[model samples]
Target: MAYRRLSNQSLVGVLIVLVGVVLLVDTTGLYDTGFLLTYVPSLFVLVGLYALVSSDFRNVGGPLVLVTVASAWQLVALDVVTVGRILRFWPLLIVLVGLSIALGRVRPSVAEVDDDRFDLVAAFGGLDRRATSKTFTGGNVTVAFGGGELDLRDTLVPAPPARVNVVALFGGVDVVVPRDWNVRLDVLPVFGAAEDDRPRREAEHDGVDLVVTGFCAFGGVTVTN
Candidate 1:
């Protein structure tokens, strides 16, 4: 038999049927212990179907279902699903769902430009820079600029350290360099502080240079090595 897609309304109807089934089973005192475990997969299927059918779903219901399922799974995993606990977490879950839906509406466009060097610019407010052609083997590279963020974390290659230069106008920045690589940071007057929590020196390895500059009207910056 071939699989068939269910509409959002049909999925909701199916969910209602499943809930009725659970209620009937509970009243009969049969397999009561695994009720939630048995229903979670069904609920996930219904939510997935709902997300597929409704174009406006992701902007509204998708996040709500996701947060609800995640919360339920956590509670079931910890074996702590009491009525009071569920009630207490419900409001927080609603807030998370609402926030996710609101944020999803603000979509940002990303573009990659290639030139003489490995230049990656996510210009939200027209900031520009050129990255040097250095071998950045094993390290984490993170660049956040102008309400946009970029992270190249946990590279498995075993090459030399990396160098990064960034400029931000009104956003946040965070980067993590490898412990073995040597690193230097230069920030312009517009750029804010260079916050790093890594140790002064590590074992045998060289760091890289990390320079950041911007007009951070309401921006923050961070870099680590």
Candidate 2:
């Protein structure tokens, strides 16, 4: 069965709300912010729960759980490292993004767009989606302080002409459609770029037409074949 579009923001929002609730609980004088150390591991645990519920979260949640364990190991086994120690491991974020890309590839293949409406939003993180749809018409994608990717490389475009509304601020969105599809870009790029990287052909667009209309502020949108 298909699940709701689980973007990075949605997952991060869950973690944030959890942390806020913990802090809110502590505000009753039961414990201080330091007490959060006791429940730090729960952060990744909750993300893990989302992983089990939504396939879209598995790629991100799995690596987050691993990172949490590593962090906990440093905190407990290494006598509580300082914030600088954690920053040193920031490169792992790139590694996790690589893992997310690889993880997305190994997922079981399915028809991605079974619904008429689809929404994807990424904030404070990155989301990679490779999908197929026989009934896909139009949708919306938003990215802020983050990035998102939509790969429709191998999909059936029942709707030849579809529109995708994109909003990127301090972030970017990358799209991959069929090679033969005609791309109409109408995005306002402010201190940013919106480009089509596909090789051009003079042939007519007998396949599908993807009109990308959006706003990019301090960010960009890329369309590739």
Candidate 3:
């Protein structure tokens, strides 16, 4: 198989550049320490931009934009808003996810696709959701300094196999797939580990295959049935 560089690799590079710039500014005494954290939310917007341009990841970009802006709002409210009051705004994720799914980013009439692909991201937070695709093709999962739970156990896959690409940096990702399917682990972890929990005997020739491939940097990947 030909090696395909993931489109989100650009997003990862941009994040690294942003972090470097922030450090350089702080080193030059141009900005204080906490200053960098405030602009951290913009990382999502940057990722959203990358996704917006990618044919496969466009559907996920909008939700990332919305979540980033809402998270930034919470940061701005730090002066007058109480912790509880700020926490109340957390429900915006549910609303945004619903809206994104309702107003899908992918077209229903697209060829070779049974359903539109969606993106899931978790940055300094957690995500727990499922896909509505009957013949789920594939999507991306990104976690930066946070945790994410992607439940695809209920997803129908009349298609033979699907890919779920993941990138976890200083975070954790838990992928839940159907019990009867076979999970192929093709991940490379640098200061982390990827565990495939599917039963070897039962899932030997499996109904379908889920290829879990990606890189984990100082993070973890857990696959469960």
Candidate 4:
């Protein structure tokens, strides 16, 4: 039998369903699951772990920060530590940043890949790329303490919807698509913002549908035509 891995989209849908179920059960007042909310921060730990596994541990900086912040908050929520105590260790972020830089330098660099799909990363730098693939598929973009731009105005997707995951941590990403295309933004912003700045059109065009989804922590992702 062939093994099939779950896509992030499916995983997110499952989580949403589960959350709805939990909320429904809570409304009945038969059992108290309110305490479970305290563990909500742990979701970031899961996200970090997933990112590590999915990227074969190549994408580290942003995920590591997510896990660290979530862990600190979890500890405080559980009454295991106080907010004051955690604040004292906040300087460790500087150390983590240094480690991330060192690890990035040691990692092997990848040459430019096919235009159909890409895995672009901008860590402590800037990245600008344009996609012109006729069979344009979805791809990923990660920005950590840096900026990135993915211009797909000249690209043509064979399919209707292409899913692109963008992660911005202490940085920002700009996605430029064709004016005729429609964008579905489902990104989560934590102390940040994600905006779709495309001009409103009265009639829909027969262009590709782009689904932009991911996390923005202390950063932003802007989609424009």
Which digits, one per residue and each the tens of the lDDT, describe model 2 over residues 1-225? 988776554455576587787778678766677656565765554544544344355345344545555555547534577666776877776776677677658774332544544666654456577666666676777676667788876655576677887878798999888877887887889999998888853245554477788888899999987
Instruction: Single out the weakest 10-residue window by summed lDDT for candidate 3.
Output: 105-114
TM-score list, all predictions: 0.33, 0.52, 0.55, 0.52
Give me the candidate number with maximum TM-score.
3
What is the C-alpha lDDT profile of model 3 across 90-173, one tens digit per residue? 777677677656655454412132354655555544455566678788788877766777778767766757888888889889
Give per-residue CA lDDT, model 4, range 1-225, as digits (tens).
998675454565587588777777788987777887778789767866666565555556766777889899999999999999999999888887788778778865322334777776555455566777888888878776767678888787888698899988899999898877888888999999999888943245554488899999999999987
Ranking by TM-score: 3, 2, 4, 1
Comparing 2 and 3 by TM-score, which wins? 3
lDDT of 1 by residue, 68-87 (tens): 66557666655677656666
User: Looking at model 2, how many pairs of residues clash?
Assistant: 0
All candidates' lDDT scores? 0.44, 0.67, 0.67, 0.76
Instruction: Give, for candidate 1, the lowest lDDT window spanning 10 residues.
Output: 123-132
The lDDT leader among the candidates is 4
Judged by whole-model lDDT over C-alpha atoms, candidate 2 comes out at: 0.67
- Candidate 3 lDDT score relative to the true structure: 0.67
CA error at residue 72 for candidate 4, angstroms: 2.6
